[model samples]
Target: MFLAMRAAVEETLAATLDRLGYPTDDLGIEQPPDDIDAVLASSAAFRLAGEAGAPPPKVAAEIADAFDAADCQYIDRVDTQGPYLNFWPSEQYFEHVLETGQDDDYGALPDRETSVVVEHTSANPTGPVHVGRARNPIIGDAVANLLDYAGYDVERHYYVNDAGRQIATFTWAYETFDESELPEPERESPEYEMVRYYRKANTYLEDEADEAEIEAAEAEIQSIMQGLEAGDEAAYERVSEVVDTVLDGMYATLKRLPATFDEFVKETRFMRDGSTDDVIERLKETEYAVYDEDAWQLDLPDIDKNLVFVRGDGTSLYTTRDLAHHEWKFDNFDEAVTVLGEDHELQARQLKSALEILGNDTDRLQTVHYSWVTLPEGGMSTREGTGVDLDDLLDEAIARAREEVEDRLDDRIRDDDLTEDDIDRIAHQVGIGAVRYDIVSKQPTKGITFEWERALDFEAQSAPYVQYVHARASGILAEATDGEGINADQAVTELDSRALDTPSERELLRQIARFPAVIETAADDLHPHAVATYTREFAEAFNAFYRECPVLDAPADKQGARLALVVAARQTIGNALDVLGIEAPDSM
Candidate 1:
């Protein structure tokens, strides 16, 4: 609906420019300033004035006079202010919004029939998932949700780094631990046990180990890598066991955020299927491929760096495997969206460049590189055993949410028939929602210092506040039985737009009307944080409308109109929360 209105306004401006004998090629429109009493504003007149050698204000007036409101269905008036022409929406636009806002598909766009592969959270399965790496899954999942809402066919994936040295190190640590000294896997998760020894192994190699011991470990890891690369049954079984154990714990952590993947692509699969060797041969045929010493490298003079494709030891680098993986992605989907860390920015670029060198269109691959996340104490390292475990973080969030929920529901606990289990369920939702929203609400390229107080603050810009507003709107609709003959659904279908003329009501309607535009923008920019920001603004507008407008106490016509607005606000907020992967509860 917003897009339709903008199109109508633009058409009017273009027609006016054509009628005035001015070029319409560079004409554009933008949102007016808050002080301006208009829905759509444009400064095209200023540019047109310069082009036509006329005064800016005089050109603006001429364009305003030339605009025909009768030609535009949604815009009613066009007025000139200084060097701008402002367009206001007609009553028909508000009526259209009111009539269509009750449906679940209110803000959705037509399906574009494009398939997108979103790959993210491919963390090395070396330890339990940590807080430092938690943002990837949240942001990635939110992007997938937004794309899905925007009518794209999105396939979420996790590219497992199961063939890397990290996995070999994890396996070696698990195998080298003294059996009697190791914790029982039955009592503790295998990943948890492996992480303890993994840290010990790294520390031993770094500090206390002698050169002989270091060489032994390195040789063991290399042998394991070679065996896996050769598709040895024993090597595959042993490595798969360790990778599966770690992934079990990782998937459990991911489930807490409710993030799931449609597929899990193994890096070793490319090695076994000969895609890696094929890519190496292809690169070798290109002028960019150079034989440096005993290794094959891609000499990128543009970046003044040479990327090694094959080591002198005959092993392929991570980039080689990534190139093959992306080749598979491009073959399967129309587009591939990768969410990786800022540290991998150069690797992502190299992957695209290598693909381009191989005669493939690299533009199909979109990479979103997010910055690091840290706690208030400082940075975290998994190998040092210094990061907050995801399980521990969730436990703390749920515990804090339990306290808040109990306190909020203390007075009505009995009246609402609430039990301990109910409190637990609500707390789980609130806790996870808070964590997900706090992590995903910030711009992905910016670093965030995760703070407990800020994340769980109910009055602040958190998920709980938005969820509560949704619940509040729900409560109002549920109690809207004023003994009148008017039905809520019927009222929505028969809504009267003039009854919503109050400042708060119109403002709320305007916010609700912007939902589809927000979703489209987020999907186009690959920025899920925009949806989070929009939901908060929508919630604020709803709250203001609720406080200032009398709903059930108003006259029959006004009550029906306000009720329709309530229903629209509730539905829109719920949709926004869904896109953000947060729960919108009916009650707190």
Candidate 2:
């Protein structure tokens, strides 16, 4: 309803401006500020005041005077406040909002014909994921969820860096290092267990290995890289076994956070299938290609630095292989989104420039660059073994969440005879939700200092708070209908907007009405934090309504209306949480 109303207001504004001989380039339709007593506002009057040779207040009044709200079903009236043109929603609009908000699929947009592929979390397969790099998968998953909710055909991908030097180093460590050499005790998971070998090997090379021994290790790693690139069956099989084992453990960790990939693409595939060579050959023919210093390079006009595609030894760089992968993505999907860390900003720009020089459409690709998630103590380094592993963080979060859940549900556990498994399940949900929310609720460009208190806080703008609101709404509906055979759906049919007469009721209704608009905007802008912000506000609005207005205790005629409101609020909150890839529990 908010989107529809905004559209009507924009259309009316455009027509009015054109009639008044003013420019309509900027519609300036936006939600009014908190102090404004309007549903929507347009600042186009201010934008056009310069051209009209008049003050903004006069221009706004002129536009408001000439505005036509007769044909708009959702707009109540248009008025001018200083330099702003504010719109109010009609009673019919309120009724339509509540009526439509009751649908199970209230927040999803209509399906689009476009297909999108989201590639993210392509961490090196050398060790376990740490909390510092946890933002990648969390943001990637939520953005994919937002795109899916916005009706795009979305596919999630994890690009395995199997052809890189890091994989060779890990494979060498796997074959060379002894279990006793591990710094810590062996872990049950392969990612955790094998990382010990890699760390020990790195430490030995860094702190104890002689020059001759270091040279031998380097030679072996080069041999492994060449063998993998040349498709040697023995080397390929050995590396594949280790990579798969590590990825298995990594996937287990991701599953706990509920992030999954539709595909795992190996970088070696491009090397073996002649795709990388094809890319090099194509670049060699381009006007920008430069063969200098025994290396193949592209001196792009717009890029400050030259991109080297081939080294002196004739081995292709990761950037060259990435070109092949992006080409394949362009060939397969209508659009593509790649999530990268802030360090990759230049590479992302270079990739687009290279693609454009190759005559492929670079406009179809989007890149989201996010800052790192550092610990409160400091940043993390996997090679140095001085970071908090994601598995351990998750374990700690689950333990803490269990303590919190026990505090809230102790009486219910005793009275309702809840099983241990039930508590475990709820704790897992809350813990994972808290972790995912902590990473995704901030703007991607800003770094986050992950703190346990902020992530798991029950009273603040955390996932637990939103989840609790959902559970509370569910409880209200359940109690009102317990043994009465009056479900929320039945209350929906008799819902009347006029019955909800209080200011708090109207405010909550307006907030609920904004869900669809929020989804559309967030998806278009690739900002999942916007969804998080809207969900928190929605939760607060519902709480306000709960306090100021009673559902079960209302007058008989208004009781059903308020219950219908609860039903809509519950579904809206659930939908918002789902977009953030967080679970909505029915019970606290």
Candidate 3:
């Protein structure tokens, strides 16, 4: 309803401005400040004050006087306070919000008819995903979900880094190291099992082995890389097997985070299929390309350093291969969003600059650079073999969540009998939801420390808090009519906007009305945290209404309207959680 009202307000305000003999290009409609006590406001008068040859307050008064609130869709009246034009919603607006909230597709936007590829969490297939880099997958998946909800056809992708030196080192370790020297598997998973080879190789090179052994190890790794790039089919097949084994383990952990990819594009494919060579050849002809220090480099615009695409040995760098990968993405999808760590910002800019120099449209590609996720101990490094594994973090989350669930079970036993299976399922949902929400709820540019206390706080601003509100509303609805619950559709039909008169009820109605607009803004800005913020606000509004407004014990005519409000709040909260890829359980 907010989206519809905003559009109507814009159109109506533009007409009013045109009548006042001022430009109507940007009316500067904005949300009113807290002290203004208005649903929407505009500061266009300030922008047009010079042209109108009058003060902003006078111009605002003139526009408000000319505005026809009765004709607008949801706006009831407009007032000029100081230099601002504040607009309030009509009773008809509340009626529409209550009726629409009961629908299953409450916050979904109209299809935009664009297809997008979201490439994220392309962590090296060397070990299980760790908490340090977990932000990539969580943010990437949530962004995809937002796009999908925004009506874009989105395909999630993981660009497998199989052609890098890391792969060569992992392969070398698996094939060269003695089986007797490898440690026993910790978790009986392929990722856990295969990473030992890489870790052992790293430990030997960095700490244990002598200089001669290190030289031999590095030489063998160099040979494997050369062979892979030189199109040695046997070497390619062998390394591919190791990569697939590790990926199996990685996928197991990703599934627990509930992140899935529609495509697993191998970087080696670009090398084998001549796409990498094609990229190098194109860069060689560009004006920015220069042969310096026995390597081909492109002097990027506005940057002091040149981007190296080819090394002294003639092996193309990862950036060059990434160019080929992006070209593939551009060919197949209308747009692509790549998620990367803050450390990769330079590489991303270089890629775009090189793409521009190649005469390709670089606007089709977008990059979201996020800071690292740290622990109380410090940062993590897969190479150094230090960091909390994603599996371990999730395992501990579930165990801790189980204790919370057990305590809640004892309190609610008289109302609902939960079996052991129910307890376990609820534990997983809350645990995973806490982790996902904790990471995705923060601004992508900021780093976060994963804490169970904050994430699982039932009374605080967390996923469990939001989920518990959902369960509370469910309990209220279920207790009505002897467990049959009020028929939400029927209640919506009989909903009376006049009966929803209390301040708390009005606030909740306002929050429910803003759901569609919140999603649209988040989708446009590529910010998933916006929806998370909205969900928290919506939950708070519902809690206030629960405290002040009676649902089942309301006056006879007000009962159905209050029940309908509950239904809408429950559905909107659930839908918001779904957009974040977090489950909204019916019970706590």
Candidate 4:
């Protein structure tokens, strides 16, 4: 509904500009300031004034005067504030929102023909997922959800880094360690066990292992890599088993966030299928390709760095394999999005450069490089065993959530209405939601210092707060119908827009109406924080309306209208939470 109004405003502005003989090609419309009580605002008059040699305020006034109310039925007034033209929505518009906002696809965009692939959480399979590295998957999943809500056909992908030296080191470690003496797999996940041995192996190679042992390990890893490249069945099977075991633990962790990948693309596939070789051959034909120190390199003077595509021993580098993978992505989808940590910024840029050199469209690939997630103590390192495992973090979150829920539901718990299972389920949802929301609610480029108190806060801008608001709205509606039911469509049909006269009521309606616009903006900007912010604001608006106005206790004529508003708030908030990949329980 908001998007429709925005479009109507844009169209009216464009028509007014055309009538005034001003160019409307580059005119942009945005929301007015919060204090302005306007739906849409535009400073296009400022630019147009410069183009037409007129004062900006005068031009803005002229544009406002030229706006035809009939052309934009939703916009009741257009006024000038300095050089800005702001538009206010009519009561008819609010009524339109209350009527249509309860639809299942209320905030969804029109389905598009474009296909997008979102590849993320491609962590090395040698270690368990750590809290420090959790940002990528959370952000990536939210991006995919946002795009899906925006009507893009999105595929969530996990690029398995199975061909790398990490895997080889893991394999060597597993072989060298006596399984009987290693940490019990039941105590920690298999991935955690593998991580311990892998770190042990690294320490041995660096500080304790003899030169011959080091050489022997290196030779064995090379042999494994060769077998992998050659598609030897036994080698492939062995590596697959190890990677699959680690992935089992990783997937278990991700399931807590309720995130799932549509596909898993192995890096080894590129090497085994000759795509890596094709990339190397194509690079050799490019002017950027050079041979230095017996290695194939791409000398990019523009970036003042040289990226090696192949080592001195004729083995392909990670970048070479990644180029092939990106090419494959482009060929299969209209657009590809890769989510990585800030540390991979250079590699991402280098990947684009390599794609450009290969004569592929670099614009097809979008890389979102997020900053690190750290503990309050400091940074984390997987190899040093200083990183907090994702499983452990989730367990802590759930434990905290259980305490909060139990405290809040003390009466119900004592009455035997809220079972232990119920508490557990709600705790899991709230806990995972808290962690995911905390990470994705921040801008991608900013680092987050995860805190249990902040993350699990039930009163702050966390998921639990929003979920509680949703539950509160549900409670109001449930009471209105005496726990029977109030059909949202039927309730809306009885709505009288005149009853929505209070400031808080109008503000709630406006916020509920903004859901579609927020989704669109988030998808376009690749920022899930927009949705997160909107959900909080919507909840605030609803709470204000609830406090200032009576729903069931209102007069007969106003009761239906307020009930409709409550239903709208509930549906819109639920939808917003869904887009953020957070569940909105009807009862908290």
Cα-based lDDT for every prediction:
0.85, 0.88, 0.88, 0.85
Per-residue alpha-carbon lDDT of candidate 4 for residues 165-205, written as tens digits (9 for 90 to 100): 88877877777877665555424666776676778788878
RMSD in angstroms, all models? 2.1, 1.9, 1.8, 1.9
Query: What lDDT would candidate 1 get against the real structure?
Result: 0.85
Weakest lDDT window of 10 consecutive positions for candidate 1? 181-190
Candidate 2 local Cα displacement, residue 519, angstroms: 1.0
Model 2: per-residue lDDT, tens digit, 439-522? 899999999998889889998999898898898898888888773534555667867888988888988899889999999999
The residue-by-residue lDDT of candidate 1 on 1-588, one tens digit each, is 788888787787888898889998877587688676577788897788877798888999988888889999888898988998888888888877777777788777789899999999999888888888888999999999998989899999999998888888878887887766554432266567667767767887899789999999999999988887777778878889889888888887798898999998988899889999899889999999899889999986566667889888878888899899999999999999999999998888778888888889988889888987888888788878777877778888899988888877766664665677777887888899989999999999999988888888888899898888888887777777534665666556767888899888888888877888888888999999999999888878888888899787888768788888888888889999999999888777
Candidate 4: C-alpha RMSD to true structure equals 1.9
Clashing pairs in 3: none
Better of 3 and 4 by lDDT: 3
The parts of candidate 3 lying over 4 Å away from their true place are 35-37, 208-212, 411-416, 481-486
Q: 373-424 in candidate 3: lDDT tens per residue? A: 8878777777666778888889998999999888766656825667778788
Clashes of 1: 0
| Candidate 1: segments with Cα more than 4 A from true spot | 183-190, 207-209, 481-486
Ranking by TM-score: 3, 4, 2, 1
